[model samples]
Target: MLSRLRDRPWTTALLIACVAQLLFLWGLGRPGKLSFDEVHYVPAARTLLALAYPANTEHPLVAKAFIAAGIALFGDTPWGWRIFGTLAGTATVLGVFACLQLLFRRTPVSAFGAGLAMLNQTLLIEARTAMLEVYLGAFTTLAIAALLWSMRGRPALRLTLSAVLFGLAVGVKWAAIPYVAGAGLLLIWGKSDQRDYWPGLSLFPALALFGLVSVGTYLATFAPAFFYAQDPLTLSRLIPFQVEMYQRQTQILAPHPYQSSWWSWPLLIRPIWYFYEPDNGVQRGVLLLGNPAIMWGGLVAVAACLWAGWRRRSRALLGVGLLWVGSLAVWAVIPKSLGFYYYYHLSSIWLCLALAAAFHAYAKGRFARANEWFALPVLMLFVYFYPIISAAPLSGPQAFNRWMWLDSWR
Candidate 1:
């Protein structure tokens, strides 16, 4: 079996990533309760299904429509609410696998990278919940995947698809605006003007194609809401909703207990409690956090990447630094009054990718085969903290304290 997997590492690795995400997503959310953003998204899904006036007009309909499809297949239960999320999360894991495979054909390294992507605590928590974050994260990551694929030749189709997906991502959440810009800039930077740079594809033509597809698909996502008879704007009036949503975005949010600023996310100091229901007889709490070893070590690795880039003058190291850092940097400058650490999720995925690169770098030594053993500790820590993350009934408050290593985590 081991030999067979070794012979077909890419196939094996992809399966491992997809299946692990499915099991992980499927296992949780069985407690049958909405957590945090599920309330807004799930109900919006039902409203979309009813073809009633759109309830959550601030966000676009594609992701909720996805959840609605799941509910249509499975019934209006917790499992139904989360089925699409599980699927989206699975797609995200597979996207990481494909991206890694595209960058490094080495099976061990690619497989290890995919595993690292799934091991983040915030990812674990968000993967199972019915929320816009997973969809936005998955689509943006896939867009980046497609964008990277285009850079490796065979540019036309992949580049076009990347733009389409980017549009879909934005349609899901306005938060995706920064990612779309980031992806576009990355694509532009890498596009070679030399006629032979990307055979059979012109940079400017591909750039124009990206713009058209992005606008076209984003408008298409609003089709259902546009045709709704009750939306007032109905058929041809998207401008009103767009204007209202823009206005809504500008309004400040009231104080919320779980909110955290952009700077706090990398430190893993403030984990939001999605739920606390001791009064409901089944005592449980769900907390979102990143794995300590990976997150803390990854932060150190970020610094190391900067040093490596400076010392060796390596563009690749510098690019990796730009990716994770740039992903979080958008939130730092955003004008929102309240932001949550979960907002850091899209970047955390890339941060894990950087961490995986570090592990692959360290995999040379016989005793410290980073690729082979790196996932072991991540998985172990995930299991150790599964109780709090999954909102499983704690044995006691003492058990809870063990999980809360930081006072800010309270």
Candidate 2:
């Protein structure tokens, strides 16, 4: 089975996606109620189903529309509210696998990275809940994968697909705009032999084509919003609506207990408790935390990539490092005064890639066995912390203390 997987990359990718979907589906409706941000998106989706005025006006409609579609298909139960999120989460895992395969061309390394991403608590938690971040993360990751594929073959078609995916990501949240810009920049300056990669087009024209397609796709996501019976949005109202959204995002708010600076996210300094309650004589909780093995180990891998990429001129290493840094850097300059650790969700995917790249690079050295077995520790950490992160019943209220290893975690 291992040899077969290493031989067939697509099969490995599909298998990983299936396992991730099953993992996300298991106990998805636990606690039998909305958790954390589900309180916001689930309700907005319900309102969207009624075709009334938009509820979550500060953001775009793609993600809420997906939730609405899920409810429409599944009848608004806990399963209905969260079903699409599970699928989006699976898509995210597949995206990570695709990116790794394209970058490394090694199925074992790709599978390892995808597995690490799935087990890393944040993806699992977000996947089982109805929220915008999971959807945004899925689209952005897939967009990057598509951009990488363009470099291999069918440049025009693949680049168009990437543009559409990135636009869909932006429609989920404005935060995705940087990734779209990054994709354009990649085409303009990524390769010196532009004639081979982008045939029939020069530098500026290639960028112009990508930009036009992405903006058009972004506008199309607002189609549902335009038809809202009450206070329907129109072309004339679009720009003003963007200004309102920007203002809402930037406005200062009272400090949140779980809010942490962008710098602290890589260190896992704080995690937001998505749910905590006593029910049926047991304590249940869901904490938005990353797997410690992956979080800390990934930092070392990222530093290695930065050093090796610069010295070796490896596009794969440079790309992974840039994507990881770019995802987190946006938070530093964005006007949003308050941030949560969950915001690091996108960067976590790149962290997995960097780790996989490091492992693949060392696959033939004395540490080959150690590198191959790294997934064991990552998986073990997930299993050890699964109870708290998945809302499983705990021994008592103080059960969380066992997992809270750092003073800042509390």
Candidate 3:
């Protein structure tokens, strides 16, 4: 049974996703109130359900739409607000597992990577709350996984699916634009060396076709917003609304307590406190810190991937390194004056890929078993930090002091 399961990557991926969903769902309504940006998004979702003029126009509508769906199904409670995010978070874990399987064809390595992703704290907190980042992360990660799966066979269908997923990602957040561009560049690179890479079409035409499909899908997500009974958005106003969104995104905002720069993200310098409050006699908190073992260790692994990929011309390693760098690099150039560690949500999953790739590279070495055991520290740290990250009741107000090893984290 074990051997058969190992041979089937999707089965392993599904199993990992199921476990991740349970973790995400556990104590999901602990705070029993909106946490962090849920204050903004949950209300927007409610307004969306009312079919009123769109709220939260700064972001595209798809994520709020999903949130609205959750509310409609589960009622206007914390569980209803966050259930879909939990599911999306589970989808992200599944996508990470599938991507690793496609890149390395090793079920153990892929499952290990997915496990690290679930324990990566950022995903945990975001998944349990009503937020856009996890939804955006799920769509973009799945799109990348689909692109990789397409490389093996059945290009037309999978590639089209990839485009649609990318579009949905953009509809969740414009942050996906760079990733969409990265996917196109990967396709172009694939065509240069591999025959029939994109089937019959030449480079530019294939790019154009995917681009159109993605844009069309992005526009389609606004269908709900367009039908508002009051101040309904019209086709004529669509492009102008996008321009307004860009301006809103770029305008400098008042400084936030937890904001950090893109360069500081991988270092885990400053993490956002999504929810920190008293519940009865105990203090409950939810911090967006990454698993330190994975965060710092994955950097070394990513460097190893880049060096080995360049030396051996391995597309998988190079793609992992490039996508991680590309995702982080966009934040540096975007006009948003303020940034938060949570913005690194998309790039964090790639660290799982880097670690998996690095482990796969060393599978035959004397320390191969030791490499596999690396997940132990990752899991241990996750448990150690679970109380604060999960909004579990801490012993006292200063209970967070134990976890605040770094001064910057405070």
Candidate 4:
């Protein structure tokens, strides 16, 4: 069984990603009203679909463009707009799985990472919505996977292609900036410092290639207005639109009904209920929360990542640190005007990576052999608590009854 599993075909990885995505899309089920940030982006996407580029937005039209694509395909239903996000999410799983294959050179770990992602409801929930973050994340993962694959002497064509994907990621969401920076650092390490590293001829060209692509793509969003505008008011609308978008990002959010700090996120201390109602005589809603087992277990794993980075400076540990530091940096320094739990999507990817690294370290069996067994119980506990977190259909106070260990989860 082990041998057969290890030797599973590469197609199986793609299949796993596809199946997971299909399941999530199916669960999305209906075209409900705009929930959460949908209110902001959906209208903008409608504007974009009509070819009137809205101004003052911090992000490029890539995500809205994607939403537009769904509209074009299926005609402006909620499911139609969100299908793109679901597809992006699947692509992300494949990218991460491929990256694991490249980094660790083991099919099992690659399979494991993708498999775990398939089962992770948090990632699924986010992916099944018309959100830009998942789109950004997918492109970022793909770019990273391409970069890592290039390290193995794959193809120069891939190197240039990866740059375009990185540009797309930045165009989708600015959160991916840190991961892009990390890729540049990896090149520096491979070229100048590492002992066994072979400095490839394409490395410098690749960096310059990606740099130009990212900058040029970002600037291109403005070109339509600059070149094709019919009147001065067209220009006027563009500038303020861009400024408000930028200001909204940096503005410190005031305390609101459901605001949460960054510190409370990882603990799953307070989950935001995305939809809640008793109008139909029952509570039907969706709770935006993290996987408790993964979230809490990741705390220990992240600490291990820090220790490993400090002591041996292992490539894996260093990768984890870069991911963690970069993902959390904006939240740490930026003044908060509007804050919510979903912002953790960027940082949460690191939690997945950190846990994977910890499991990889222990998989060598040098540490306590019993740790592997512990994963079973942890997995069970995560499954047990999922219904409440999802708010599937729990009656009256039973819905809030999972307040057993984590009182703050209430």
Candidate 5:
């Protein structure tokens, strides 16, 4: 056992972390009742499975539809509806792995960065839940990864595939808007001066392909409408259904107890507890919090990315940095109410990217390696706070004490 533990490398760390995530998730399986938002989504999923979304369902059907598919197979257990999310989360980690390999191109630093992201608590939590954030995060990461691959060599079907993934990300959640836009704008900029780039008809064809996929998926979501309709064209009723979805999202600012502004998220000032039960003796509960080490360290890493961008103007690094910043800028400007910490899941990917860039720079000797030891302290912090973050075991006062940096976490 001792030798086996000693033989483990970074990948093993990620695997262990993922195993812990799975166990925690399994512990949450069929915990008797739904948590806050799952009440809305799980029921919507069940409704979709039953072919009974209201004519005016509020959000896009893609995610709920995904949930419905799982419920069909797994029969509405916690793991049932959540199984798709877990798959997406695993795909997200693999996407991050592919993206880092594309970004750094066969380097140990690239592998390390991917490992860091895999072990990340934020990614693990979202992956284990029946939430749309995991889907959004997976598709968005794949889109970015495909973009990176396209940039490194001659464009082909892979480039087209990247665009398709970009569209899927948006289809999953309109929150993907900024990241998709950033990728599209980068593609345009990359192809601008090259006369042979064929920016016109070639790109349009790929986009059309994406549109066809989107339309077919959207229509299939309303398949129930065809069951009892007197006419074959009854599927057209989905148009008004879509309009209602858009209207609900535009006006949804309902009051929520855990609402926190976007500004508060970066500092770990607010965290949404996805599931909690003080009566459960803490052995079998889940508490959600951003990894403070990764999050706070990200702020410093971003500043460093800015400095590196100004000095080197590496288009690759700049593209990565801009991708991160532009995505966050959207959250900064949106008028949506109760933008909780989970919303940061998309933005947090970029934060990890920023930290990757910082680590890459250190590995390349752009700065002294003396401060590399700083990671030890950060790792220690993650370890020290794991109990409270996971709600493992603690007195009320102990839990309260860990809420040290709260601004809006009440």
Candidate 6:
């Protein structure tokens, strides 16, 4: 099985992603209640479906609309509320595969990156719940792939498609705007006759068209949210609505139990728990945590990429790191009180890619077995933490405590 899979790395990576999604879906509806953001987004979805303005105007509707679509098909069960998230999670994994393929052109390394994406506990946790971040993450990751594809010869179509996805990603979460920034940098670098990969597309016109299409796609996403109300009128009301949203976001200065500063995020100092049913009989909970081996290992790997990229003058390393840095850095500018652990998703996405690069580079060095050995501990961490991450019933407080590495986790 291993030999056969080694010959077809993309197929293997996709299978792993699918298996993870299937596992997420198999017992997905358990605990049977809305978890964290689900409590907010699911009702908002119902509102959209009913032709009423949703309560949380702070967030855009693209992701909620998806949850609404899921609910429409699945009939308002827990499965209904969270089903799209599973699909989004699967999409994120595929995005990682496509991206690695473009960047490294190595099927095994790309496959390993996809595996790293699946291994991130927070990514999996967000997938099992109804949250905007998963959709944002998935769409942005795919848009990154599209942008890379656009770097090839006569890539106007791919660039346009990438713009559309980036626009959709923005509509999912305003946070995804950073992806557009990353794309812009990539497009700018891909300019001219000294092309490394493909015969470059017309530079200026293509960039202008890319912006136009991106804006068009973004506005199109908001189009559906407006039709239900005619008297208040959608387009005219949008500016005021966004102004109000910005006001609300800024006013989130009060402390939150689960909130953490952006600085604490990369260190894995705090994690958020989205749901819990800690009854006297059985204690079940879902914690938004990472596989420590991968999370910490990723940090080291990314740092190594810093040195390696600088030494090799590696464009891929620098570009991938830029996404991670910019995403996380922007959060520092946002209200510190409003920041939380889940915001780490953006950085984590790129970190997975960097980790794969590390594994690839390490394997090529004298310590050829290092990367494989590293996977052993990562796999062990995933299995050991599965119960808590999935809300499976625990043995007792002791069992729960065993998983709790710090006070903030409580």
Best by lDDT: 3
TM-score result, candidate 2 = 0.97
Q: Per-residue lDDT tens digits of candidate 4, residues 1-410?
A: 65765777476686777687776676463325566677777787877666564443656678887887888898777777788888888887887688777777667667666765554556766776677878887888889888877676744556666767887887787766666677777766776765523345445775676677666665455544443233323555765755666777777655776787877777777776666554245555566666666677777878887777678768767677567666776677655566677878756666666666667765564554434564565567556755544335557645565544555544
lDDT of 6 by residue, 1-410 (tens): 87788778677776878786886686787667787888888898988877675467787789999999998999898888889999899899889988888888878788778887888877888888888988999999988888888776458888888999999998887787766876776666667436543354566777797889987888788777666652333787876877776677677477778888888988888888787776435777888888888778888888777777778888777666666677788887765347888989878878889888877665675777677788888889988899888888887656778887888788
lDDT of 5: 0.64
Listed in order, each prediction's TM-score against the native is: 0.92, 0.97, 0.97, 0.85, 0.81, 0.94
Per-residue lDDT of candidate 2, residues 1-410 (tens digit): 88977999999899888999999999877767888888999899988888888788888999999999999999888789888999999999999999999998988888888988998889999888889999999999999899889878777788889999999999999989989888877787755553456665566767877899899898899888887889988999887888998888888899988889999999999988898888556789998999999999998888888878888888788778777888899999988889999889999888999898877765576777766578888988999999988889998878889989888876
Q: List the global CA lDDT of all models.
A: 0.76, 0.87, 0.88, 0.68, 0.64, 0.80
Best-to-worst TM-score order: 3, 2, 6, 1, 4, 5
Q: Which stretches of candidate 4 lie over 4 Å from their true place?
A: 53-56, 195-198, 202-206, 221-245, 278-282, 309-313, 365-382, 385-410
Candidate 3 residue 60 Cα shift, in angstroms, is 0.2
What's the C-alpha lDDT at position 177 in model 3?
A: 93
lDDT of 3 by residue, 213-315 (tens): 8999999999997889789999999999999999999898999888889999999989888878896567899988999998999898888889889999887
Clash pairs (backbone) in predicted model 4: 55-241, 55-242, 56-241, 56-242, 252-336, 252-337, 253-336, 253-337, 253-338
By lDDT, the candidates rank as: 3, 2, 6, 1, 4, 5
Evaluation by TM-score, superior candidate among 1 and 5: 1
73 in model 4: Cα distance from truth in Å? 1.1
**Candidate 2, residue 50: how far the Cα is off, in Å:** 1.1
- Compare candidates 2 and 5 on TM-score and give the better one: 2
Measured with C-alpha atoms, the lDDT of residue 394 in candidate 3 is: 86
Q: List the RMSD of every prediction in angstroms.
A: 2.4, 1.4, 1.3, 3.6, 4.8, 2.2
Residues 1-410 of candidate 1 have per-residue lDDT tens digits of 76687669667766876666666665565456787888898899998988888688777888898889989998998778877787777777777777766665556666666677777777767777888888898898888788878877778888888999999998888888887777666656666434343467666786688888987888789888755658534544676778788777768889998888899888997888887666246678788888886787788667766666677766556666677888888888877888898888887887766766665554465746755565678889988988888777777555668877889998
